[model samples]
Target: MRIAFYGSSLLSSYWNGAATYYRGLLSQLAKRGHQITFYEPDAFDRQQHRDIDPPDWCTVKVYPATDEGVRSVIAEAALADVVVKASGVGVYDDVLLLGLQEAARPGAIRMFCDVDAPATLAELRAHHDHPMHRVLPELDLVITYGGGPPVISAYEGFGAPLCVPIYNALDPETHHPVPPDDRFRADLSFLGNRLPDREARVDTFFLDAAARLPERSFLIGGNGWETKAMPANVRHIGHVYTRDHNAFNTSSMAVLNIARDSMASVGYSPATRVFEACGAGACLITDSWVGLEMFLKENEEVLVARDGVEVAEHIRTLTPERAREIGEAGRARILKEHTYERRGAELDRLLRNVAAAKRERSAA
Candidate 1:
């Protein structure tokens, strides 16, 4: 089937959180014989910061940020069997989304792929005038990256006939274990940008733990983190490239996960790093979330840390053998349930089922 993806960043994730996902999902779909064309707006320096190039499995097209971009996206998606509009690309993408919804011909499924569940719902509820308001019913399907149960209920509550989750998946070829370097080696490390909402959590979970473990070494790798003053022990290595993620994960005894404000509040989205860290065979330590266990076993595959004290306790007590055991368990679980191939297969089934139902309705 022909599928077109319109998302935040199709080939780049430099400052974007959705890159690894695009690469993994699209690549898997491509391998599965689904023709894919990823259309992204050349906005927010995204073109300049391309992290992973589109593989041979799919085509990548960049459109303008202006009104002209919609025409270009429509032209490319004219005959797609599926058309998806993903959230948070920073483009004035409402224009593009509305255009796709209008231009979609029969047989093509048009979707609103909401990566941030609670945030999207909040925006839609707070202001029905928001771009997504009128188009809720026009979409053929709605999918989210996270938000186990509550998310789907909320979207359905808003009148979506069909809603599903296309959770994050790992690409083992890219996110596997490797020898660590001194730069990223730490008792604990976190890699994420500075968002105002997530900053407080970072302070409470990561910085607080770093402060408590003043005698131990810590590392931070990501963009938008230069302005904050850090404890001398916390080494801030501005931005770690896609190439370095494995080394960073392998170096740390345990990698920390700090959920974005919306995800934490909604309670289900685990960052790609969680899967990547575990796929790379690195032990994971995540901030307490309502449904963390649904993704990975709590205190078994993943260590849940509610405060700085808990974070310190986990790190101090973890032995290398235990870390390896936990990492192996996580890797097995991800392969069984969280790899990109697995996610793509699930989506394939969902798409087929939806398509079948649509056909039956049309015949009636």
Candidate 2:
């Protein structure tokens, strides 16, 4: 299958959280003998801070976010077997959505891949007249990163024929145990882009934890957090590159997973960092949310904390041997059940099934 994916930056993880998701899924899909082309805009600073060169498995084209640029890409995308217009492209999303829907035309499978389901669905629900609602009935398939019954039902209610949740998973080949980097060494760590929806949660789960455990060393990494006030015990590293994720994870005694407001409320969503940290053999402590048990067992594969106090206790009380045990257990679970290869296979099956069902309907 030849797949065309239009998404946020693929070569950089600068302000793009979906980069890891796209790279993992597409890389595995390519390994399975699929031809993939990724289309991303060149407007973001990602191009300036690019951590990697273009990957060999797939073609990545960075185009201007202009009318002419989109037209050229649309024509090329229309030729593929599947055309995916993913969420969080960071610019002209409405225009892109309409263009992709038009490009899909009579034959190509049209997909809306929502990297942020809670926010996407919430917008659709809050405003029935959202531009997306106008195109919802026409999309052949709808997919999301972190969603469950609530999100699926909402998308279906908005007129989607089929909506599926393809949660974040590990890509062990890219993210696994590595020797800890001295620069990132800390008792606790967190890495995430700063977004309005997530800052408050980060403050609660990460910053507050640092304050409560004043003696413990805390490290923060990612963009947009440089200006935030920090405790003397906390160290902030701006913009940790994708290449350094494993070392960043391994260097910390335990890493934190703080959910954004929308994702936290939605409940089933786990950020890509969660899997990456676990894959790197980091003991994981995550803020509380519903449906967490479905992904990782509480206190066995991961530790769940509801507030900064709980987070402090978890970090302070964990013995080194016990932490390593939990990290190993988490890694085992991810390798067995949640890898990009498994996700790619699941996607392949779903696409085939959808195509077969469509053919039958047409024949009838």
Which model scores highest in lDDT?
A: 2
Candidate 1, run of 10 with poorest lDDT? 68-77
- How does each model score on lDDT? 0.84, 0.90
lDDT tens readout by residue for model 1, 1-364: 8898888776777778888888888788787788988888888887887776766788888888877766877767778889888888687667776888877777778888887788889888899788676788777799888998899999888878889988887998889989887778898999998888788888888888888888988888888889898887888888677888999999988899989888987887888989999988889999988888778998678889887789888888888898889988988888777888888888888888888887888899
Candidate 2: segments with Cα more than 4 A from true spot: none
**Mind sharing the TM-score for model 2?**
0.98
lDDT of 2 at 181: 94
Candidate 2, residue 313: how far the Cα is off, in Å: 0.7
Error of 1 at 51 (Å): 1.9
